[model samples]
Target: MSTDTRAAAPEVRISGIDPHWWRQAAVYQIYPRSFADADGNGIGDLQGIITRVPYLAQLGIDAVWLSPFYPSALADGGYDVDDYRDVDPKIGTLEEFDQMVAALHAEGIRVVVDIVPNHSSDRHEWFRQALAAEPGSPERERYIFRDGTGPEGAEPPTDWTSIFGGPAWTRVPDGQWYLHLFAPEQPDFNWANPEVRADFLKTLRFWSDRGVDGFRIDVAHALTKDLTDPLPSEAELDAIPRDAGQHPIWDRDEVHEIYAEWRRVFDSYDPPRTAVAEAWVERHRRPRYASAEGLGQAFEFDLLTQEFDAAAFKDVVVDSLSLAAESGSSSTWVLSNHDVVRHATRYGLPPLPETVGTTEQDRKQGAAWVLAGAPEDQLDREKGERRARAATLFELALPGSAYLYQGEELGLHEVGDIPDEARQDPTFFRSPGVDKGRDGCRVPLPWSSTGLTFGFGSSSAHLPQPQWFADYAVEAQERVDGSTLEMYRAALHLRRELQTDETLEWIETGRDDVLAFRRPGGWVTVTNFGEDDAALPSGEVLLASSPLVGGRLPGATTVWLRESQS
Candidate 1:
C-alpha cells in the first residue's frame, strides 16, 4: 500500500493539483477591457490576454475566468449578450479565441467563460422576435411577460432594487411590463420554457466543444427569480418561504436541474469541467445554489465585504465561512473583481502625486500611505506596495478558492481618475454620481515603463491605463525580487503547500475579523482583518503578504499564516 503522503495525492492533478483542478484553485478574473490591449483598437483584446497568460501561470491560479467576450452592445459591460456564438468585434475574432485557448493550455491554465444566460441583449434574435410578436406567443414567452407588472407605476416584479441602482422593471411599448433585474436593454430569461433551456445548453456545448474548458455562470440565482404574486425585492424573495417560488413549473429547483445536466455534459467533453456561480443574492439564499450538488464552486462577496472594527470583521468571517460549511459547499473568496473597485483603493490608498513620480510613465511613484503629513504637490515616489501586499495575503489565506483579479498581482489600484468624457461605462450615463459603478476597477492594464498609451497598445489605449502602471508593470516587477510581483510568487509558492486537488476541509470557529480553517491535507490557515490579528494558536508562517506576521501585513495590511497540525 502507498504511504500516507502518497495516498493523500489527489486522483486528479493539474499544475500539481487535481486534473479537474479549481477545487483549491486561486482563480484570477480577467476583465478583458481592463486587462491588456494588444491590437490598439483603443480597446483590450485576446492577444493582450494571451501575452499575459504566463504572468497568470506564475501567480499559481489553476484557471482564468474571462468575463464575456460574446458580441454585445456594451450594455452592462457585456453582460447583455447579442450573439451567443462569437467574440465581440470590440475585442477580437474566432481565430484569436483559438490562439488564446492554445496559449493558455500550453501553460496548463484552464479557461472559464462568463456565461450570461439569465438574460440577453435586446438586439438578440429571440428578443427582437419577442418584441415583434404578440405577448404570450411562443416568441414572447421566451422572456418574462406580464399584462400588468410593475411597482406602483415604476415597480418591478418585486421591491428588489437594481445593484447598479433604480427600479428593476422596464415598461414595454405593448403596455405590459418585462422583468429586468439589471438594465432595461437586458431582458430576463424565462427558465420555465424548455426551449430557453435547450438554447442555453447548446450555448454551453458551443464553446465547450470549441475547446473552452468550463463556465462561470453569471447572475445564477437571479436566473431563478421568483415569478410569484408577492413580487418581492431581491432579498425578501429568498426569505419568502421556499414553497412560494417552488412549483412543478417555476424557480430554483429547475435551475439546479439544468446545472446538473450541464455538469454531466461537461464531464463527457474532451476535458471534464466544473461550474462556478455568481450567486449574488441576499445572504440567506446563497446556500441554495451550492446545496443542490449542481455547481462545482460558488462565489461569496464577503472578501469584498467591508467595514471597520474587529467585531464587525468577525461577524463577516463567521458568516462567510459558516454558510459554505453549513451546506457542505466550497466557495470562491473574492475581494475585488471587474465589478468593484480595486482593494488597494477600496481600502482608501490615495493616488500618488506626480512630483515624486519617477519617469514619464511613472507619473505616480512613491505615493505610499502614511498616517499624517499629507502632501499637496505630486510625489517624488509613492509607496502603496505594502498595502497592496496586505490585501493579497488576506485573500490567499481565507478558506476555499482565492480569486485574484488581473493586475492585482502587480499591486494595481484604481486609476488616477478618468474624466467623464473618456469614460465608456454605461453606469456613468445611467447612474452618474450615485454610483461610480465599476469603472475604477476596469482601467486598461499597464504593460511597460515606456508608456505606449496603455502599457501594451501601440496607439492611445482604448481605456485609460494608469500612468503609474508602466514602471510597475509585470515586466518591471519581474526584475525586482521584493516587488509586488515577487510577493505574489512567494504567496503562491506557499499556497501550493496547501493542496489544491482535495475537497476543502473547513472548520467554522467563531470571529468575523478572523477566518480560521484547516486544509484537507492538514494545513491550517488563519487570516486577520484590519484592526485585529487573526490569531492562530500555533504554526509556522507558511506564507505572508506583509513583512510583519502579527501586526501590519504587507500592502493591504492583511496577514496569512499556516500553523503546525498539532
Candidate 2:
C-alpha cells in the first residue's frame, strides 16, 4: 500500500455542523492547580490556561473542562466552594476568568466549569450564619443541621460515615450536628430548602451569562438525600447496594429533579448550554440522569474502572453506547482523571478481578494493594506505554465523545513516591497510611525538559514532579517521531477527519485477546491484547499506536485501517 493511499481517508468538518457539538466532540480536562502557573506563584492560574489555548486548539479537542477554581479554603481540592460567583484569588480573579473564557472561545474551544452544588465550604457566609444562629433558626435552614440524640446532645445524629473515612456528622459548638458527606470543611446543603435550589440556579446563570458553555456537576447524584430515613451503619454504608431504587444519600430519584431544573436553565440560553453529571449510580439508574429532560450527558465511568483487557473494554463501550441510545443522549468516555491513578501505571498492574465487591473493607484493601504495588521501579514502563497508546487509539475511535486528562497524552505515569510531608490530598490524611490518595495523578505537567518546574512555571510546582518527567516533557517529545504526544496529536487530528457519527460494529476475529470493530466510513480499529502478534485485516493502515510487525498487529498495540475501495 502506498502512503498516498493510506492518507486518502475521507475528511469531514465537525465544528459548525450542529449546535450540539458536545454529542461527538472530544473534551480535555484541565486541572488548573497543576496545568500551568504564569505569575511564578507556584500555583496554576487562569492566565496560565489562557497562555495555552493554542496548545489545546492544536490538540483538536472541542472543549476544556476546568475543575473547580472557586474561592475556597483548599479543602477537598477546591470542591469546598466558599463562593460560587467568583474565582479563587490563588487561581485568578473573576476578571481573569472572563478573559480566559473569551480567549478559549476565540480558539473555538468551549469552557465547562465544575459546579459543586451538593456542598459548600464551611467558610461560606451561609454556613457561617448557620453556625452562629440558634437551633431551629431560619439561617440554619440552608444546611443540614440536626440535633444530637444522646444526653447533653453529645452523640451524632446518625451513624453514617464520610467518604473520606470518618464520621459524616460533625457536632457544632451549639449541641447540633451537621452532615458532610465528604470532608468536614464541606457542609452538605439542605436541598429541601427553597433558598438552596434558587441559589444554585442563580450560580448557573451567572457563569452561562459570562459565556461559559456547560458544567461538569460535582457529586451530581448526591445532591438530594432522604434525611427522613435512618442513617445506615458503617458496614451498610460501605456495602451500599447498587440498585436503581433510593439509598440514604446516593442516586436518590429526587436528584433528577434538580438536573431537570438546570436543564431548563440550559435550554433558556441561545445555544442551549450543556451539562455532564459525575454520577456513579447503577447502570440502569444512570440513564435517568441523562434523560431528555435531565442533563444531556453523564460520565460513563465503567471504562475508567475496567481492567486493561479486550473483553472488558468491549463490554464497557457496548454497554455505554446502549445506555446513551436509550436515554436520548450521548456517551462520554474517559480513562484517567485527577481523582484516580494514571492509566499508564494502572495498565501496568496485574489484572483486576472481574467484579469488585461492595464492602468498603474489600474496596480499600484492593485499592491499597494497587497503590503499594505501583512504585516506579516496580512498573513495566515499556509494556505500560504500549498498552496506553493502544488504549488511547481504541478510545478515540469509539462513536461518542472522549475525555483527555492533562498529562495522559504525554504517557505520564503516576508519581507514586510523593513525599509524605508535601502531600495535600484530604484522602491521604483521612485514610492515613492505608491509602496514598490521588496526589500521584495531580502532579504538575512537564512542558520543557530543562526548567525550574519543567516549564510549568518559573517557580517550583506546588506538587513535586518526578525527575524522570524530563523524558516525557512536551518539548522533548514534540521532536521525537512516534512519541506519545505526537501519537495523541495524530490520533486526534485523524479522529476529526475520519470519524463518523455512527455506532460501532464488532468484527469477529475468533480471538478472545483481540477486539476488532468497524465504524461507518470503511474505517476499522483493531486492538491486540495477546502475547502473540495477530493477523491484520485486508486494509490500508491509516495509523497504528505502535509499528506493525510483518503486517501483523503486535500485542499491546492498535491500528486504524481503511478498507481498500478497489
Candidate 3:
C-alpha cells in the first residue's frame, strides 16, 4: 500500500484494510517523548513526530501508536488531559497535527493515537467546575460522587491503591473526595453515567474527523471500576499497568454495549474506523467473543506479565487466538508499549550496556548468542545476545498483530541514571521505591553522537534525548551495517517481504528453538537460535544472520523461506 495508490482509490472511505487491518499489521509504538525532536525544545511534539514519519515508514511498519498528546499539564507524561480537543502547546499546534495526519496517510501509513478516556486532568474546566460546586453542572456527574454515607456515613468505601502507589482516593480541593487511579492531577470518569459514555463518543469523533484512524485507549480497563465491590474484583486490574496479572475486575459487561454503539457510529462512516480495547476479556466474554459486533479488537495483556516462560507464552498466544476469533474476528497483540519497560530490558538483559567494551563485530556475535537463548543469568552478556535474537524473532513470529517499542530493535537497554531533579514521571515521585517510575525508559531519543543528544540535533531535543544512547545514534547505526538500526530495518523489511499480502498464518513445526511459520503466500519464516548453522527440512533458506548453507542460519538468525508456488 503506497501513498499514490491509496490516494487514488475509488471509494471516499479511505480503503485498504477492513476495520481490522491492524490485526495483521506490525505496529511500532513511539513514546513521542523519546522519538526525534525537530524544534529542539528538549521535548518531543507533533512536529517532531512528523519529522520521523519517514523513519517509521522505512522501518516497514504498517502503523504507529503515539502516546497521548492532548492539551495537558504534562502530568503523567500527557495522560492527564486538560482538553481533549486541542493539541498540547508544548507538543505543537492542531494545524501541525493535521499536516502530520495527511502526511502519514500520504505515506500509506495509518496513524493511531492513545486516547485516555478513563480520566482527565483535574485542571480541565469540567473538574474545576465540579470543584467549584457549579449549579446543576453536567461536569460534576461525569466523575464518581460518593457522599461517604454508605456504611453509616463512615468507613471510606474501598481501600484500593492508586496506580502511582498511593491511596486511590484524593480529597478534592473542594470538601469532597474525588478518585484518581493514577495521578492526583487525573480524575477518573464515572463510566456508570451515560453522559460520560456520550462525551467519550464525541471525543472519538473529534479525532476521527481530524484524520486519526483510531486509538489504543490507555488504562482501558480502568474506565469501568467496581466502586461498589471493595474497589475491584480482579487480580489483573488490581495489579496496575506496570505490574503483572491484568485480569479485568474493571473490564465489565456494559463496556460491550459502549463498544457496540461506537461500532454503529463507525459504520456510519465510509471505510469504517477501528477501535482497540486495552484490557483483556474472558474467552467467553462479550468483548472478546462478541467483539466483531461491537469493537474491532481487544488487547491481550498476557505478554506483559511474568508469563515470559516459553510454554506460558505459547499458551497466551493460543488462548488469545482461540478466544475472540472464530474466522475473521479481530485479535490484538501485546508485546511492548510505552508504559512497560522496553522488552529488550525486560527479558533480563544486563541493566547496563552489554555490547560495549568490545569490538563492534565481537559485540554483534555476542548479541546474537544473547538473543538466541535464555540466560543462565538474565543480566549476563552471554545470554543478552540470544534473548535479544529470540525476543525479536518471537515478536515477529506471533500470530496476531505486533508492537515494537522505540528502542527495542536497537537492542537498547533500560536507562539506569535518573537525576533526581530531572525525573518527571509522577509514578516515581508518588510511589517512592515501590516503583522506580517509567522516566528512564521513556526519555528522549538520542540521534547524534557528537555528545549527549544522540545526534537528534542538540541537547535541546523535545524531551531530554539521552546522552548515553546518543552515541548509538541513528546515523551512526545506519553507517554501520551491523548496527541495531540496520538489524531492525533488515528484520522489518524481511517481515514485509514475507507477509507480502494481508495475513500471517503459520504452523508450529514442533521445535522450541526453531520457530517456523508460514506467511499468507506460502512463504515460511524459519528461525534458528544457536551458535551454529541450523537446517530447515522443507524449503531453501532465503535470509540469514550470516550467509547460510541453504541460506541456513548460523549464529542466531532468522531465515525467510518460500516453497515453490503450485
Cα lDDT, all candidates: 0.65, 0.85, 0.63
In the order shown, the candidates' Cα RMSDs to the true structure are: 9.7, 7.4, 7.9
Q: How many residue pairs clash (N, CA or C atoms closer than 3 angstroms) in each of the candidate models, in the order given?
A: 49, 0, 33
lDDT of 1 by residue, 296-408 (tens): 66787664654323454445656867887766666667766876556665455444343432221121112122111233233213334454465566557655678878888
- Looking at candidate 3, the ten consecutive residues that score lowest on lDDT are 1-10
Find the candidate with the highest TM-score and give its number.
2
Residue 245's lDDT within candidate 1 is 38
Deviating ranges (above 4 Å) for candidate 3:
1-20, 134-138, 149-156, 226-249, 280-290, 304-310, 350-378, 461-467, 500-512, 529-533, 545-556, 564-566
Ranking by lDDT: 2, 1, 3
Model 3, 77-153: lDDT tens digits are: 88888887777887787778888887777777888888888898988877887887852366678886554435443
Better of 1 and 3 by TM-score: 3
- Whole-model alpha-carbon lDDT for candidate 3: 0.63
Q: Which stretches of candidate 2 lie over 4 Å from their true place?
A: 1-17, 236-242, 353-366
